[model samples]
Target: MSDVTANEVTIRQYRPEDVKYLMEYAEENEWDLSMYDHLAYTRIDPNYLIVAADKDDVPVGFCGVSQNAPDTIYFGNFIVRKDLRKRGIGRLLWKAMLEKAGDQNIVLDGGPEMADWYITHGFPYQAYKVQFYAVKVNDEMKQNIMFKYDTKTLMESMWPDLMKYDSQVYTNFDRTRLLRAWFTGDDVRVAVAMEAGKIVGYGSIHRKPNGEYGLRNIFGDNEDVIEALLHNMLSVLPEGTVVHFMMPEDKPLPKYIQHSMKVEETAVRMFNKVKIETNNEKIWFATAHTV
Candidate 1:
């Protein structure tokens, strides 16, 4: 680990007082603050988030380690100022936060530019490359697919069914608390896919402050379940709205969705030391900065 304390840079646990600076960093970089807030609120422990500052006490970068389950640790929001990157600040920050994870497997979805850096440090490929897709909501696009299953607004009573599908779709991690918060939180709408009188899949749609519609979380066992959930979610959005979704590049869903949507960007999921088996084809959208 780099000795940040011995140099001009210092790494320390994040504090409530750091919110303003962190928010500014997030906004300046065009990143949504919601993801950071979500991680902060749902983190396994308070000390998992670490911030690095220059000798003058100005925040330079920050990173977080989250225990999605007791054994699965997720690395997220590792950002350094554009002017400060390539100077070892990010490395120092991550090294400090990573210690909190101990021996747990580390996982993250990062841009291609950082893939080599992460691989050099220990994280190797665990899944196919993922891409973000976007589209302007309209009548013609919404008519692209016919739902083979039915979907309804998610209910607290369906938590068990949601958990069942989540366990199958998301693999080993138990993200119940995080999923619940995201699904029921203000300005968010969740739909549950149903077939044969049981929940087969679920998805959450949230309108971002920037007027974009985020297909926040979508998971299912097959195309029919995903198509049903997506149809219900998209039906709620108004025309001309920009909708966003993420899927693995190797998955057929992207090709199906790209019939109306445009490719926005891509990222790769990497893991350190251990690869957590995940069903990449079963996911349509995932947490941008988490497993």
Candidate 2:
């Protein structure tokens, strides 16, 4: 165990062996650890995970930041143990992360309760709204839903339509990387909804390494098409598999999902800006963490 004075915490790159301690901290805070697993975290570039430890050589907190570009860094998960709160460990971790991040703009998804914290720390409130939902998948339902779209074949043929619709929804028009990552990456499945020979909606399912599944970037102008795509994905997964989704708060999709799945979880989208420039429009939905 490495020792540091109680007045200061030691921050360092995360080692693979640190997973046990990270999981313990997450459990203590009631935060879900299913999204991150050995494979996913290991696959991430080593420079991303930053850890803060106390004099006793115990991890008090940690943060994961993804450097998408030379000018931008996206925060993934930032947390401290419940019992260690208000001890300045979290602030130390944040400061260390920002220093390592250099001049890049840092962004994160946080809850409403933490807004004041960020505001006090020098980040402006840019936007605030999102909803999370979970549903159990079953085999019988999977067999009943029709699989009308082939993701691979469409990837080759529908590039034009896909790019057009994607730009309409996102603030920025760079879906090329995201599209490739979701459709071509391992453990990810993409499906589209079609009616009368036209693409109406699409959905992608990414099964994380820890047996948990996430519904990513589902979109459609038609409500029925979105429902169909969701139902198809749910059916293909194993019975009782829990699926989670995040969508805009004002969008009708959340209410529709709640009515269909009977389960809901709410989380706010908070932001802290290293550079301050106010925008007139609120960011209702984020295209990717990089944005």
Candidate 2 lDDT, 15-100, residue by residue in tens: 76776787777655544344333234334445678888776556767888765445556676588767667778787888877787
Runs in model 1 deviating more than 4 A are: 1-6, 27-47, 141-146, 253-264
Model 1 agreement with the true structure over 29-61: per-residue lDDT tens digits: 756445424443454466666788777676778
* RMSD each, Å: 3.9, 4.8
Q: TM-scores for all candidates? A: 0.84, 0.75
Query: Considering summed lDDT, which 10 consecutive residues are worst modelled in model 2?
Result: 278-287
> lDDT for model 1, on a 0 to 1 scale?
0.71
True-structure lDDT of candidate 2? 0.59
Alpha-carbon shift of residue 83 in model 2 (angstroms) = 1.8
Q: For candidate 1, which ten residues in a row score worst on lDDT? A: 35-44
